[model samples]
Target chain A: MNTYTNRQWIYSKRPENVVDERHYSLQTTSLSTTELKENQVVLKSKYFSLDPYMRIQQSALETWERPHPLDTVQGGAVVGQIQDIHPSCREFEVGDWVLSYTGWQEYAIADVSGLRKLNRDEVPLTTALGILGMPARVAYFGLQDVGQPKPGETVVVSGASGAVGQIVTQIAKIKGCHVIGIAGSDEKTKYLKETLQLDGVINYKKFTTQKEIHLELKRLAPQGVDIYYDNVGGYITDAVIDSINTYARIIICGQISQYSDGLDTPNLGPRFLHKMLYKRAKIQGVLARDYNNRMPELLEEMTPWVQQGLLHYKETIVNGFENLPKALNMLFYGKNTGKLIVEV
Target chain B: MNTYTNRQWIYSKRPENVVDERHYSLQTTSLSTTELKENQVVLKSKYFSLDPYMRIQQSALETWERPHPLDTVQGGAVVGQIQDIHPSCREFEVGDWVLSYTGWQEYAIADVSGLRKLNRDEVPLTTALGILGMPARVAYFGLQDVGQPKPGETVVVSGASGAVGQIVTQIAKIKGCHVIGIAGSDEKTKYLKETLQLDGVINYKKFTTQKEIHLELKRLAPQGVDIYYDNVGGYITDAVIDSINTYARIIICGQISQYSDGLDTPNLGPRFLHKMLYKRAKIQGVLARDYNNRMPELLEEMTPWVQQGLLHYKETIVNGFENLPKALNMLFYGKNTGKLIVEV
Candidate 1:
């Protein structure tokens, strides 16, 4: 009987503000690979996906799912290679790269049915955790389906340097839209303007108030914002909403700005629903999970674009199993320019 | 030359709070009927529509249109009789009842193309101002088109006793929805529950806080709210939003609560866009003017429902043109049961 040592990051405490080491505890367990059940495979996690939604799940209130049950393996997606497999698992071979929702663990036992075989020859294995993963799914559908961007239309993306926003900005550009990206730092804004070739960029950190941000948006988008893709939803959302043109579409993909301490006890902002009435606009919330069944549809188009170098992406990798919790905490501080991932 | 003494309520000053006589100046002018232009008819205003949107336009900020220009007769809908007609005006005849956008004046010249002929015998003449008029246009489309209420689904309406809201609640009931209404006073709640036969009614004034109101909604709607028709935007909206179910549709028809003083400087409310992402909900704004071209389609269905008494309505008529501004102001106080009209 062969055995492997598995290290797991257990979510111990619920977070009221930012998630840190105090919220998670590392645990070591021994797993016997010889006793694998039918259709099960032992996975050695290579990369862990860190998302803002993890903080939202740690909230005391009920969100998309019931507060990702406490004292469990910190639930998340992982990109890994199959170390061992049950004899009944004929679909996959040993040493095959795959994507699985096995969370932050050095080794995880997963069902063969739950694993997506990753072809490293096609794209980098890390791309499975980002450009072709959940972030890309939301950015593709949220912007294309919900936003329905038209050529010559103005699209404003908040958190424009983040995982989802970067893809959203690129897709908007591909759609021939006059795209504007709003980020927290000058480096992010610079990348969005120079690399992403965005029509406009606003470093929201420079603005003291929502009014100042709104003034900057007004100066950049003189014709008015046609579609607002909001990820950071605090004062930045308030400012972008004020600049929406008549019949505008607002896609609420994420509220990273409010997820920290505001999910349970929401922060107060000025009511701007009157603007929706005046503009005859529509605001729709989009989640990547909602399009989980449509991943093939997404890959059919996105896969080709990614291969052709038309779809640009960046991953800020934090190496080491111990830094899993720390990497998630860094997301809230706007330290990562793109997707934040922990590599084991 | 035949002349009529036209008393016009010129919007003299913009109100920071409630609109009143102080904001308007009543001027007497002699309009000559002999000077009617081609395709123009002389209209003697009988019923002046006092709506919440008037207050929105009075705001210093630009709404759907520019702020209602100062020192001009306040723009509004009027149900009146054609006293005289130009020789080339073939559509309208003298003494015919019609609806026109004639503002606050007791008499005005209207182009034949701008008037919608109202048959007083088919329904009450004032029905042109309430059930079968602009209010009904928004109510029908806002509820049916935007809300898309399904059978057995829970529908909650804020400002449930107002002109548009009354129609919305009834239409929801007709669509086989379990309708709940939220209103200011017990009298209004009684009307909603007993008169309209809603599945539930919440007297929002009884609850001092949003949490209390949210708890009341939870008690009333155990399955959760699927559709929310919001005519009032404030704490009532915040509470109802908290009680929404997955895939809920929120119709922002009017924000009467914010129009008085909150329009220019919006009041603060807890951010709830995070809930939208969790529930995959939609919030859309609908205006009657946007459906103006589709009035015939609305009338085809609504006109009969109203005539057959299947669709019920009420009107709080305030007599005399002298009370025009006061009647408009009374809406903010929740004094009117249904459509508020100033009879000249």
Candidate 2:
């Protein structure tokens, strides 16, 4: 029997504010190929996807699903290679690349049904964590289905340099929309403007108040925002809402700004829902999991865009499994430009 | 030439807080019917519709339209009788009851195209201002079209005794939804529970904090709020949002609580949009004007309901045209139930 050592990060504490290393405990275990059941395979996790939702799941209240079960593996998506497969598993072969929700671990035993084979030569393995994966699914559907972008309409996207927002910004441009990208750093704004070629970009850190941000957005989006793809909800959302045109569509993809302490005890902000009434606008919240069944449709369109270099993406890859919890914390600090991934 | 004395409440000033007599100047003018043009008719305003939207229009910022122009007659809907008609007008004769956007004036000359003939014998003429008018229009579409309520779904309506709320509550019940009403007073709660037969009622005044309201709502709606008809936006809305079930639809028809000062300078409230993300919910704003063309559809269904006594409504009619400004103020104070109308 062949044996392997698996290092796993166990979620040990619920966060009241920011999630950090203190919330997780690293544990080591041994896995043997002899224990593999029929139709099961052993996976060596190559990459782990770290997302803002990880923090949201750490929240005490129920979100999309029950708060990540305490004292278990920190559940997340992983891009891995099949290390061993049981004789009953005919679909997958050893050494084949695949995607699985094997979480923050060096090795995991997954049921073959739960794994999706990845074409190693089609795209980079890391893209499964971002551009060709969950983020792209939400961006395609959230903007196209809920936002219903039209030619010449203005679209403002917060967290523009992040995974979903970056895709949303590019897609809006592809749909003939005048896109304005909002990010936290000058570097991210530069990428949005020079590389993505967005119509406008705003670095929210330059503005201290929502009123200031509103004024800047007014100057940039003189035609008024027709669709706002919000990923960071806070003063930035308030300002964008203030700048929306009549019949605007606001797609709530993520509220990373509020996932910290605010999710447990909400942060107070100006009441602006009255603006919805005045503008006859609509705000819809979207989750990538809601569109999981439509992945084939998303990949069919996105795979070509990505291969053709029409869809641009950046990945801030952090090395080492021990750095997983620390890398997740980088998202809240706006330290990463795009998808934040950790390689084991 | 027939002469008449017109008492007009001219909107001379914009209010910073509650709109009252200080914002208007009462003027009396003599008008001759000889000046009436082709396709024009003279109307004697009888019942002035005092709605919460009036305060929204009075805001310093633009709402559905530009701020109500200063130094002009206060714009509003009125149920009136045609006193005279030009030879070119064949649609109606003198003494025919009609609904017109004639403002807060006792007499006015209107183009025939802007008037809809109302049947006095079919229902009380006042019904044209409340149950069968703008309030009912928004209530019908805002609840049925935007809300898309399903049977057995739980609906929570804020401002349950107000113009739009009363109609929304009854329609939600008619649609087989379990309705919970949040109102300002025991009288309104009693009306919602006893008269309207709502499943639950919450006197928001009884609870000082949003958490308390959320707890009470949880106790009342153990199944969770599937639809929230928001006529009042503030802590009440914050609480309802907190207790929403997945895929809940929130309809924003009116924000009476925020109209006074919040419209100009938005009031501070807890930012609960993250809940929207967790629940995958949606919030949509509906304006009566957007569904003006569908009035016939609304009247076709609601007229019989009002006449057959299946759909119940109330009107706090303040006598005399001189009280128009005061009646508009009553809405902000929550002093009137259902529709507040000035009966001249």
Candidate 3:
């Protein structure tokens, strides 16, 4: 029997704010070939997907039984190659590439349920972390299903140049809905209209006045918006809620604005409750994990779009595992455009 | 044709607050014995379901709609006999009893889509306005589905002695849940535990401190409340929002605390949002109309429980159509238990 060792990112202590270098301490541990469990696969990290959801898992969802003495690596996205596999794990062969939620580490051991066999030939394995896996599926399901975007209806997506928001805006356009993209910068805003082909784009940072923000949104959504994909909460959420048309639907995929502060109690303004009644709207928080059943269909739907150059992706790649914290910080500050990737 | 003209409760102007006689002016007119439109039914009023919903309707859902003239009637509950029916209206007969959304009126005309023909012996006709109709179905469905109560799970229903709250508490008990009812008065609180058979009851008016409120709820719900049905908003809502268990579900049926002032925006202190994420709880606002397809099934589930004397109801009846305004005011003020009915 061969012995194998792996570096695992474990949640050490709960984070109290934006996850900084101080919140995580990376350590390399060894495993003997004899210690490998049945159905375990040793994965060599390839593509790492940085997401806002990782913030919650490190701070709020660290309920594991492992007794840790504070700082350690926190968990989330990694696309990797299977270096070794226990025979009991029949899902993959030793050389197969896979996307696993292995966090910020060079290598990790995963049970069969956590790894999905990757077909990089259809779409590159790296795309699996961004436009093809969680963000794409979140875009596919959140807009098409939860937001219930209808043709000719107006749809607005905030954080438009980011991984999830970029796909959401494009999908809305494909469905014949008038898409409006709201981002923080002029360059990303320009790219949204010219590159992504969204019907309208707004650089939200310019509108310091509520009246201007309201008027700009109203101009973009003349008939009023039928769907709002709220990735950014606080004022963006407030503006979107106020602008919704009758029977509008909002899919709350993430609250990037609030996440930085570590999900504090949000001041939900009054008009929101009133709108929920008058517009007969629905707002639901959804995690992509819940849509695991639809992954095959999602890859199928998004395949042609990516291949034909209909769907484009941009990656801000941090070359070493050591810079994983910096990559994560980029996402928290809204500095990265498209997907933030760590290549080890 | 013998003419005994019909009258309607119409919204003359936009109401800025809880509707008073000043906000309304009843108009009477005679209808010609002319041919009816397809899918139409002419009805004579028996009981109108005066609800907090009418307050929104009276404002024409405005803060959200076009600057159109006030609607023909200030909406309320109504049960009436079919006075006439369009030849294409397949569901009704001249003598059939039907419950409808016909406003404060002695008589009204409705389309088949808005009318539900009633079976007299199955439950009292008034049940359409109270226990066996919209309010009852809301309590039943919201609790059974969203609340997902289990035996020993603590469920709190605020505005506990109102029309919907009374039914929610009873249904929770039927499903083997420990029920806690919150009302405004001691008399209503006594009725909640003794007559309504709730496991525990609290009068929020008596609990002066938010800490006391939390402590009392913590005592009754030692395991932490699994569900909260919020009918009344304001401090009571804030207190219950704090006491919920992880993964709790809140069915937002009404916020009577905001109905009277129209301008009363309950400031949910900023931390409530964090509670939602940390608790992984769900808060959903449900309109009974959206649950229309389940009405027959709702009656079937509730009737047997109601017939076995397992369900009890109380009504604060005010006689005459003139007192309709007063009856509805009681509903907003949280001054009545069970359903408030008007003997027109």
Candidate 4:
């Protein structure tokens, strides 16, 4: 077999505050003999997911359990085709498209347990990294399990144009909730209203102060929000939380606003207890990984919706393996409209 | 029958800040000879309940539902003897003791539906205002329904010496959880540990700073707290929330800490989203009245425990109807060891 080179992004240093390419090192390694261990299979990645969560792993932040150390391949979910497999491995065949947490590399030696084969004929393979995959599952579980939006209830979603937020908005809408999407730019808010047909869109950029945000939220959710799918937790979340009705559900899916600073930044919002006590609200946090075992149930409900054009998704794909850092930074700046991915 | 005079503390003015006697006025009204309204009963209050919730009604603050207007009789829960009833009323007897939301008055004319008859032989009549009544019901529902403490889990009770908090602590222990009580005084803490048999007690007054409280919490709850029954919300809550374990349940029962100032004071605690996201914790607010229909189930379980000496309660009773304001102020200052009540 002809030798192929594996291009990889390695974590070199921790980002002080905002992450950039300076935090990672790109290196190339050539395959030798194409040998694999007993349970390992060599897979060639088609799409590398550039998620906001990747920044947490790269920074050695305490945001997640089992923090990744420096000088290791940047770990992330990737859609890949199996090029070779060990004779002992029974899970895959050559050219089989599979989803795996194979990191930022072209080819990875993965175990059978680390990969799940996907059918490209049924749905586009790249969706395993976006709409039909982990992000979708996050939105589904978070919106349903935590947010629990009832019919006719107003559901507010922050970071409404991002991968998870978009799905969260659509799912809440599908659940018969009056969904309000809060985004940074007019472009995002406009797209959410015009394309997704959301109930309302509040461009947070137009509202500079907390009072402004509060007023905008009051206008959008007149009776106060019943469900809040919080993606960007800070002023936006505080504003949404301020307008929550009694028995409101605030689901914490991501705190991208604080993730940049490793959440060390001080929050000057009112203490949660008083408001919670008065409203009898429930604020719950959800991580997609925690609900991995329940994916089949999520996909069972979501797949038909996607197949029937009831659910929509967008991808901001940066070509080439080297653009991983840039693609991820797009998430931090709110530049991406939907799923931010790197196509290798 | 001889005419009787009804003396009442009317809500003369809205308290600007900390509630005092200035907000209330003593007024007397002679019983009219008018025929009794259907289903109405004349109640002579034996024990007037001066509760923290009463302060909320006394203030024009935006906490709790259905604000009270000035010059109305100050509304509160009370244990009273039936003085007279309408000829149409068949549910109650003239000498029967009942629990009623009769406000701060020696006598109140109430509808039959507004009162629940009490059994003084099984438990003390005054307990209908306290441990065997509203406070106990709050603790039972808040702890079991919201907190849901698991066996061997660390359960922290804030305002641990207060009526609801004391009951919550004991119930958590009965559920086989390690109970930690956070109180304002060393005397309260000692009572929690010695009398209530709590696993640990933190006198919050001894810890002036959040850091001090956090360190002490870390040492006591080495594995982190699994459930938090938060009655007093502020620095103590912030510290406890900081050390919450993954999937921890935080039940917000009351915010007595902020009630004194009508929750106007800004809290400098860390924002909850990031930590809650990482831990996947659930923080819920509970109002006992929301679970009012479930009180029969709570009392069924509690009556046996109280009768068996497995459950204990304390009350700081201020004598005479005149000490209502002072008795309530004692709740604000954390002067009461357990339930704070007034004998009329």
Comparing only chain B with the true structure, the TM-scores of all models are 0.98, 0.99, 0.91, 0.96
User: Every model's DockQ, to 2 decimals?
Assistant: 0.89, 0.89, 0.24, 0.64
User: lDDT per residue, candidate 2, B1-344, as tens digits?
Assistant: 78999889999998999999999999999879998999999999988999888888888887888899999999999888999899999889999999999898989999999999988789999998889999899999999998999999999999999988999999999999999999999999999999999999999999999889999999999899999999999989999998899999999998888988898888999998888888999999999999999999999999999989999888888998888888888988899989998998
lDDT digits (tens) for residues B1-344 of candidate 3: 33448776666766667766776677887764364578987788887777777665554445434432575666665888988877887767898998887778887778889888888887788988889988887788878876788887889999899889999998888888889999999999999978988888999989897668889998888787888988876667778877887667787788777666643343433434434534546666767777779888987777887778888998777788877766776777777788888867
Error of 3 at A119 (Å): 5.2
User: Model 1, B173-274: lDDT tens per residue?
Assistant: 999999999999898989999889999999998989999999999999989999999999998899999988888999999888898878889899999999
**What value does the lDDT take at residue A101 in candidate 3?**
79
Q: What is the interface RMSD of each candidate, in Å?
A: 0.6, 0.6, 4.1, 2.0
Q: What's the lDDT for residue B120 in model 3?
A: 88
Prediction RMSDs, each to the true structure: 1.0, 0.9, 5.0, 1.9
The deviation in Å at residue A149 for candidate 2 is 0.5
Backbone Cα, N, C clashes tallied per candidate: 0, 0, 10, 1
Give the Å shift of residue B112 in candidate 1.
Answer: 0.5
CAPRI-style docking class of model 3 based on DockQ:
acceptable
Rank the candidate models, highest DockQ first: 2, 1, 4, 3
TM-score, predicted candidate 4 vs. hidden true structure? 0.96
**Local accuracy of candidate 3 as per-residue lDDT tens digits, A293-328:** 999998887888899889887777888777777678
**Tens digits of lDDT, candidate 4, B1-344:** 43569898888877757888888789998764254589988888888877777666554546668668788888889999988888888889799999999889888888989889998889888778778888888899889988877899999999999999999999899899999999998889989999999999999999897779989999998998899998888778888977888899999888887777735544555676788887899989888788899888988888888888888889988899988877777888888988888987
What C-alpha lDDT do the candidate models reach, one value each? Answer: 0.92, 0.93, 0.76, 0.84
